[model samples]
Target: MKILNPAMRIIFLLSVLAFGIQACTNNAKEETSLKMLQNKVDSLNLFVQKMKPGLGELMTNIQLHHEKLWFAGTGLNWKLADFEIGEIKETVDQAKEIETDRPETKSLTMLSEPINAINHDIENQDINQFKKDYGILTQTCNTCHTANHFEFNVITIPSAPTVSDQDFKTLQVR
Candidate 1:
């Protein structure tokens, strides 16, 4: 067995040293790439975190969406006051406009045309007339939902509330 010459040993040592340096360089590059990627992800997360909407802004978004749904198109559901025949938009419109403290917007809308008609025919003392119109409005809401493929979302006319819409019955009657 002959010993390696000093020159060959030195070359072998230098080759091993070069490979060790290359491995360290590759590891450093991989770490740098991983840190850049992590930083980009953190930057995106911070941007999203800063972009959150305020409560009022969120509420406005929801309200506008609903308004679009109920008021956007010129469908039969938007016109005919008879909830039974079609159109519950009148109810929503009336409720949106009422200035009363009681938020009977649903009730006011549910009883809108019927209340007007009842007031007109008040002297008749026709319970049947009011009842019939009430049923019509209520049934119209249900029917509209059904026709629009939302049959599961049933809307019934709320029962008479303890809270009356009329504070002044005589004036209200007038």
Candidate 2:
């Protein structure tokens, strides 16, 4: 049997060690690049999901809530108005949550004060005050539309019933 000398054995061991280390280095580089690409794809998928509602559906929601608020407040149904204002605020908050990067999203934040005013009127059960504050709220909506280049989408003090299924009259005495 032939046996390697000490110096040759040392060289053989070092070569094998170096080959193993190079293989590990290549594997690490490939894994890191693959992970980076996967992370980007995941982030993009999340963003697309957030944008799924599109602008038309969002605008429709705001318009529907506005119409319901109008009917409730005008009918002197303060409780219904209160419920609707909460829905409106929550819908607006959802808009901000999902579309934080949009300029129109910032404009929606302008409704906070008007919403608060409407809330106060509802709490007081002051029909006249509610009507006045609701006008301001409509104005804010129009202002937001104008600022966002949606001036064509003018919102007004709703006078006619858009939702016929629900009674806006106060059914129960508070």
Candidate 3:
């Protein structure tokens, strides 16, 4: 093989060095950007932990889930009804957590039976049974509200479809 001249050798070496330096710079920039993103995520998480959500917000979530549960169970969408029931139960648990200072409402004992009944009805794909249990659930909610001096916060079955965005039909068969 022919030998490269001194100038050509120097040029080749310099090119390799320059490429290496650029690669290192790019890696540093990427690492710095990753660190910055991680820092921002950590900051946001800290802020969220510092902020405790109020009872009203949690209760509103429960109400929305309740509505969805009603539509799902009424439409004979058993899976959706089950999902909504789980969400409602979770929201109620979250509300109880937020209201830890108040001991009396710690456990939604009144809701347990109705919730279980609804779950059983959904499992059996029994719409009529679900409706009957749902009525009992609504009455229980009203009773709880009255006991808590929130009698004005009455819940009732919807005459027509309330949530228009979603199709309350079974999406897929499991």
Q: Number of the top candidate by TM-score? A: 2
For model 3, residues 56-137, the per-residue Cα lDDT tens digits are: 7777788888888887887778888999999988877776766676664654777889999999999999888888999999
Model 2 earns a TM-score of 0.77
User: How would the candidate models be sorted by TM-score, starting from the highest?
Assistant: 2, 3, 1
Span of 10 residues, lowest total lDDT, candidate 1: 71-80
Structural similarity to truth (TM-score) of each candidate? 0.38, 0.77, 0.66
Clashing pairs in 3: none
lDDT of 1: 0.47
Tens-place lDDT per residue, model 1, 69-98, is 221111212221123222333334433554
Alpha-carbon shift of residue 120 in model 3 (angstroms): 0.6
| Models, CA RMSD each | 15.8, 4.3, 10.3
State residue 61's C-alpha deviation in candidate 2, in Å. Answer: 0.4
